[model samples]
Target: MTDWAHHRFTANDLLLDRQLVDSRGMMAGRIDDLELSDPEPDPAGGGSAARAPVLTALLCGPIAYGPRLGGRLGTWWAATGRRLRGDGDGYPCRIPLSLVARVDRMQVRLTSPRELLPSYRLRAWVADKVIAPLPGSGR
Candidate 1:
């Protein structure tokens, strides 16, 4: 059987909605978007693993993905994301290939969890200001 068949992922699976976590294993965010490069290369004499091909990057958050989703709506979405963030160019968090440990049915496990991640401002803001104030925030 093909390796992918053994792994069992269908192409049509919803990748965008998946949650991303930190190395210490806290919920970071969802997989807001993906980035890809041209398939041809190897001029630089870099090595590769025998069993797996290298991934260029894993992108998360609105700014990193906004441009890929083109047109005026994309622009609007990007701008709004920046405003909500309060400042900055709004680049999506880039997870390097080296940090990934494995991909199971529901989530991508990372070799380095939590130690390298920062607190997610938006999540905290929403939780503290909105959800936590509600009757069942902890539950």
Candidate 2:
């Protein structure tokens, strides 16, 4: 691995679609979207020192991936994700930036294990409900 260093990054160019590996070297997921920190409100209301929005979290799962896929398929994918989640809030699996230990060209490494992430439950559910019963799945 190359020496990790902080550098200016383009979200779309550098982050989008990058695979995420957990601390235990497990595949977590690919970065599908980002949640940015809202800039702090200026106390003076003068708009002179408005803080720039910063990255807050990395998002994954079909809910975050659908839009990027675009068109009808993307729409359907997102809808299906929301349906499976069974929630009105519809937020995807959020991996906070604080958990990210390293970011390289091919993957973003996390300080936590994949099983520690909420996405793990979703994947487990899919495996149990969708995949296990399929023919030749060998589950």
User: All models: lDDT?
Assistant: 0.59, 0.83
Q: Put down candidate 2 lDDT per residue, 33-103, tens digits, no spaces.
A: 99986557567654434577778888999999999999999999999988988766689889988888888
Q: TM-scores across all candidates? A: 0.54, 0.79
Over all chains combined, what TM-score does candidate 1 have? 0.54
* Per-residue lDDT of model 1, residues 46-136, tens digit only: 6444434434556765665577578887788777777777757576667665665555456656666544643256666777898988896
In candidate 2, which residue pairs clash? none
Which residue segments of model 2 deviate by more than 4 Å? 1-6, 39-49, 127-139
Q: Judged by lDDT, which candidate is best?
A: 2
Clashing pairs in 1: 22-114, 23-112, 23-113, 23-114, 24-113, 24-114, 64-92
Runs with alpha carbons beyond 4 Å of true place in candidate 1: 1-28, 32-56, 104-106, 111-119
**How accurate locally is residue 32 in candidate 1, as Cα lDDT from 0 to 100?**
57
